[model samples]
Every structure is written in C-alpha cells, then in structure tokens.
Target: MRIIILFLFFIAVGVGAFSQTPKKKVGADNRAVPTKNKIQSQMNEATSGIAKEIADLEEQLKTETDEETIKNLKEQIGMLKKQLKMMQGLNKNVSNMSNKVIQQAFNSETSEIPKRDVNRINSLPKKILNDGELFVFMKQTTQEVENKLAIEGKKLGMQLFDTLKARKYSAQAMGQYAFACMAGGFPEMGLYIYGKACLADMNNADNLNNYAAYLTMAGGEQYSIPILDNLNSKYPFNSTILNNLGQAWFGLGDMNKAKKNLEDAVRIYSIHSRANETLCLIQQSEGQTQQATES
Candidate 1:
C-alpha cells in the first residue's frame, strides 16, 4: 500500500513538470505531421481487419482439414498477427512524432530565432550565423530524410546552409552543418561544409581536428599534408589529437611517425581504443604482428 502511494506521488510530480514545461517549434522549415487520432484509428482498424481475417481462417481450418490447408492457414495466421502488432506500434510512433512536431512549433513561435526562409537556398549571405533559428527548424527534417535521400544530399546541404544563413553563420554552425551533411551521405558536400566552417574560424581547434580527421579517413595519404601541419601546430601533444595525427601520418605511409605519435597518445591515455588500434596497425605494418595481436 505504501509503495503504491509513493508511485502515485511520483507520477503526479512527473505530470506537473510536463505541464509546466514549454513546447519546442518544428521550425520555419516544417514537415508534415499526421494527426495522432487518425493514425491510432487506422491502427485499430487494421488490427480489427487482421483479427477478423484470422478468425475466418480459423473457422475454415476447423471445418476443412486437408493437411496442406491446415499448414497454410497456420502460417497465414502467424503473418497476420505480426502485421497487426507492427501497425499498432506504428500508430503509437505517429502520435509521438506529432507531439514532438507540435512542441517544436510552439518553441519556435516563442523564441527570437528567425524563421527559415524557404526561398533561395544557394545564394544565402554569409551573415546568417547571427541568428540561432535555422538549425532549430531544419535539423529534424534533415535527419528524417538524409539516409533515405542520399542522392539528394547536395540539395539538402545547400538548403540547410541557406536556412542557417538566414539566421547567422559561424564556425560552430558551419562545422555542425557540414558534419550533418556528411552524416547524411554527401561526403563531398560534408567536406565543403567543413571548409566553410574552417574558413569562418581558423582558430577553432576542434573544427580543424575533425575536418582533417574526415579528410584523413576519406583520402588517406592524399590529405595528410593538407591538415596535419595545422593540426599538429594547434594541438601540440593532446592525446586524441595525437592519435589522429598519428593516423594522418600512417595514411601518408610514414610508418615511423605513425608509430611514434600513436605511442605518445597511448602513453597519455593508456586505454584509448583508437590509439590501441593504431598501435596494433603500426605493429602489423612493421611485421610485429605477433606482438600486437589482441589477447
């Protein structure tokens, strides 16, 4: 009895917090949100239909018992059950998505961030970073379609840039936007976004490190000379930075430098997975495979 009372109290507090918390906006760049009730109704209807079909099949199976017919009816019943469960889950997900969209809309209307300008995507001025509204609006949509819309990655990146530009442009925004573009499956566009981000703020160590890391991963030796010098200069002996620097040299076929940098990084952060992996790689390249073998 006491435990139940405590649970009820906790639930009441949770409800109060949610009721007081303000909602977020979907952004000036909105996606279509299906109504929760409609989705739920569809879910119920689908479930009913499937249940009715299964009942009919069961009834038929009882009367007409050919061995092969019974087997097929059992299989169909199993398939229909799975479909019904899936539809119900989808309906619940739809309702959740609707709430998120609605909250985002509310937050946007209350916040000072400018709405995204859906007009021209390519010609956005560099002054867009002054406002913080664009990412707020477009990030969700970009995530929603990016992997599925890999072919349209360039278009999405361009659109995102212009949307962000309508707010303000900064290394932070550019870096994040570029990274997002890359994540969305447009490697080249991601590189371009990183370029814009780096150009906007050369003093940003993280931006340089990450952008170079991306280049190192993509172009291997071809990109070593480009970002290594700058990264090494900026972050002297930082562990993760050193690890990446080691990787950059490794890609450029400088096995000695790779081994050296990776060793230094491991010395600083002994348990770093990537540093260990890099060390293992270096060992393999030097025919020290047995020594580097994972236990």
Candidate 2:
C-alpha cells in the first residue's frame, strides 16, 4: 500500500508539471502571433505586383546576353534599385556602380541574394506619391516600353509635362523630366528642363554633375565649365564629375585642362572608359600617336 501511494504521488506531480507547461506555451504563442503576422504582411507588401515585377526583371537580367537588351534592362534595374532604396527608408542617392559590379551582383552564375528580401524591402506606409515618386515611376515605365513595345517615348514625355504643370517640380523630377525630354527627341527642351533643375537645386552634387554632363554632351560646355568647376571644388574625388569636366574643357578647346581632368579621372577610377577614350583622343591630337593607340 505504501509503494502504490508513492507511485501515485509521483504520477500526480508529473501531471501537474505537464499541465503548467501549457500556460507557458500559451503565453509564448500569444507573443509570437503579432510578430508572425507582421512578418507575413511585410512579405506580402514586398512581393506586391510592382515590386514582384521588378524582382522578375532583375532575375531576367541574369540570363540576358544581348547588348542592347542588356542596356535597356540595366536602366530598368537601376530605377528599380532606386525604388527599393526609397522604400527601405534609405537615402535615394543615385547608384554609380560599374557595369561589371552590377552584372556580377545579378548574374545567374553568382547570385546570392533572394529575388527580393522582404525584410529589407518592406516598411513604407502607403500614401499618395509626391511629384518625385510619380515622375520616376512614369520615367521608368516610359523607358521600359517606349521603344520596345511600339509606345512613343515622346507621348510619355508630353504626359509627364502635363502632370508637372499641376505641381511644383522637385529637383529630381526636373532632372528626370529632362531625361524624358531627351528620350523623346527634344534636345532643346531637355536642355531647358535641365537648366531649370540645376537652378532649383544648385547645391545638390547630383544635380550639378547631371547638369554638367548634359551640357558637355550638347557641346554647350561654355555653360557647363563653370558648373563643373564649382562641383569639382566641392567634390574633387568624384570621377564622373571629373570626366564630365574633362569633356567640357575639351569642348571649349582647352586641351591642357581637359587632359589634366581626364588623367585625374582615370587615376581615381582606373576603369573609367570615357576618360580613357578622351585621353586617347587628346594624345592623338597632340601627335603622341603611339601613346594614343596603346591607351
């Protein structure tokens, strides 16, 4: 009788311990529910229609081999990268990655990242897009379909202009609008828009760089030279700005300054192809034909 009573007591103790474990589990479960739901919601938002399409395009970039198609795809990818960066509450600084690095990151043979990391991409509250956001979206859509799908890029540009008339243009929006204008084959209008953008955000390094580049491309370096000089004074180490300054000086018939800036650009970013090309052209012009060819 004593042995049986001891066994019964032990059994009751074990049952009590087991029963108490449920309360602990229930508390933990309740705590986890909110977290679990939050994560799922984030995943859903990150994989929403537009975000998912961007991911799919990124994946397609991995296998794409045609040069023209690759160029177009990279442009799309760049915009998507910016969108992702904006959504993550990070600074929307334009990316200046080399094509090699970009290709490596999204390359089929070497991709290590998921299609899109929901944890990284999700968190933004939905609201009406500001001018900058809407402009960038329209620009990306214009580029994606403008030439490839029988859609006119110029028409998109007109639509962008109409939209901009109703709202004050942000610096970024103006810059993007200029690009859209260029794409639409309105060079003079593009230059005008770029000029406005630069005036609106003269202190922005990006705006300065972009504006100078556009001026150099248009052979209006007389205007670009001062802007580039100002930018160089501020960001001496920026290779793109340096290259553009070189191009501007070259357009202005100032070979010495052009050579100096181009050389400096190459020194900073050894693989700066445009700088190398300009340097080679300068060498050829100066009768250093051997050096030009070798470079």
Candidate 3:
C-alpha cells in the first residue's frame, strides 16, 4: 500500500546502469584483485561516524523545546539510526568477501528473474490486445482490478504476458506486459517481468525505473538503492527517478535523504503528484504544518 508506482510509457534514451563493474587493481601476477580490507575499513569508519551523529542528535532531542525543532531533531536521529543500522548490516554480512565477490553476490540476488515464473507466463495463451489498448485498460480499471475484477485482471495479465513472449519479448513489449501484470495485481509476476524487461532493454530508463520501484515496494531497499543511484547519475533532475530514490530511502528509514530527494523531485517538476505527496507527508510528519499544506 505504501508503494509508489510511477509507471511511465514514454521511452528515454540511455544505457541501463543496472550494475557497475568494480574497479580492480592489478597484482604482481597481473591478476585483478579487490581491496576488501580497505573497503571494510571505510565502512567501519562510516558506521562509527554515523553512530556518533545519532548520539549527538539524541542528546539534542533531550533538550529541544520548540515543537518544530524537536520534530526535526527526532527525524534526524531516526534517519541516522537507520543509516547506521544499514551500514552495520553490510559490514556484518560482507566484511570478509572481496569486492568482486560482494558485487557478484549483489547482482545474483537482485538481477535473477525466477525461471518458473517466466516459463509459466510464457505458456499462457497470447491475447490480441495491443500495447496502447492494454495500457488504456490498465489505466481505466486499476482500482477495479484490485477489487471486484481481480480474476479478470489476472487472466488478462497472463494473456498479455504470453502475447509479449510470443512477440519475442522486445523491451517495449516486455515493459508493457510488466505494467499490465502490476496493474492487474500480479505483483510477483510483474516483478519478474520487470527484471526481464530491464535486462532486455538496459538502456531504457522507464524499464529500469519500474524495476527499481518494484524492488523498493517489495522491501528490497538495499538492492533498489544502487539501481536508483545509477539512474540518478545518468538522468539528473529526473522527477521519476528522484521520487523513486525518495521512496527507497524512506523504506530504509533514512528520512533526511528521503525528504531531500522528494523535495528535489517536486522542485524539478511541480506537477509530479507522487513527489509532491511524498514530500508533503514528510513535512507533515516533521510538524511542518504550513509547508505541508502549501505543498
């Protein structure tokens, strides 16, 4: 329910920045090796700094009197705590692994679409609905699909998936089918399809964004962050990417980053409803009543 689904139909030009290859250093034997200990030390320092900041913020909270200041202090403390927790988790989980191994582990966890789901989706009978028609159907009936029309929506989603598969699963076709599956309430299927769509069209911004959004919605904030960060670097000032980054940060309980990105998104595009709504929610939570109302 907290998912921020920002499905865009328009295609943008760019290479998919899904995974970044870690820079390697050549050893005496001319073999590339990852600097695992260096990275771990850096992480340790970051976590320690964040822990200190949280302690400072908590101490500030104890003496804060003004309602707004108090709220801001609490949010900062909460965000710092969450960030510290995440850093600690990373350190605990991957501290001993080489950078190459860590990257491989991350990619394996995030990128693989389930083979069984893909086969089942491909096995459904192909429907005659074109992309435009499918989009229209999903747009008009998403709410209904969530309620009384659930059965019909699921069937339609399956058919759409099969249709795309039969068409050789072009990036555009795969994206549309993924959207249909999402709108039709088949989230697991949709997520897998989104992964495939992203792989099929690594350069397609919409496909990557949708995949990242689904990951965040499914509680994979750590995984989504890298994808969103890559997109943000490639497409600076993009409202959709910024909004998604905000959502992912929020999911990780990094209120400060969430607010900053959501605010940036709203500033870049005033009419971005999702960005505006999320920014307003953050403001409201922080007791910025006037700002929330204005937003």
Winning model by lDDT: 3
In the range 20-133, model 1's lDDT, one tens digit per residue, is 212221121111222345334534654565567668767877897589767766765664465456555544555565645533432232112222223321222323221133
Candidates' RMSD to native: 22.0, 26.4, 23.1
| lDDT of each candidate versus the true structure | 0.48, 0.48, 0.53
Q: After superposition, how far is residue 270 of candidate 3 from its true place, in Å?
A: 1.8
Runs with alpha carbons beyond 4 Å of true place in candidate 3: 1-167
Clashes of each: 15, 0, 1
Q: What 10-residue stretch in candidate 1 is worst by lDDT?
A: 7-16
How many collisions between residues are there in candidate 3?
Answer: 1
- Residues 1-295 of candidate 3: C-alpha lDDT, one tens digit per residue: 1121122111111112223322221112211112456445545654665576567667778888999878766755664455466556655655556666633432232211112223323432244333344344333333332343346434444444454566476886577546544533356546555665665566665676666676666655655566667667665656656778887777666678788998877676665545566667778777899998887
lDDT of 1: 0.48
TM-score of each: 0.45, 0.46, 0.46
The alpha-carbon lDDT assigned to residue 270 of candidate 2 equals: 66
| Local error of candidate 3 at residue 19 (angstroms) | 22
lDDT per residue (tens digit) for residues 175-210 in model 2: 655643343334444455555565565544455555
Candidate 1 TM-score, C-alpha based = 0.45
TM-score of 2: 0.46
Ranking by lDDT: 3, 1, 2
Candidate 1 clash figure, as a count: 15
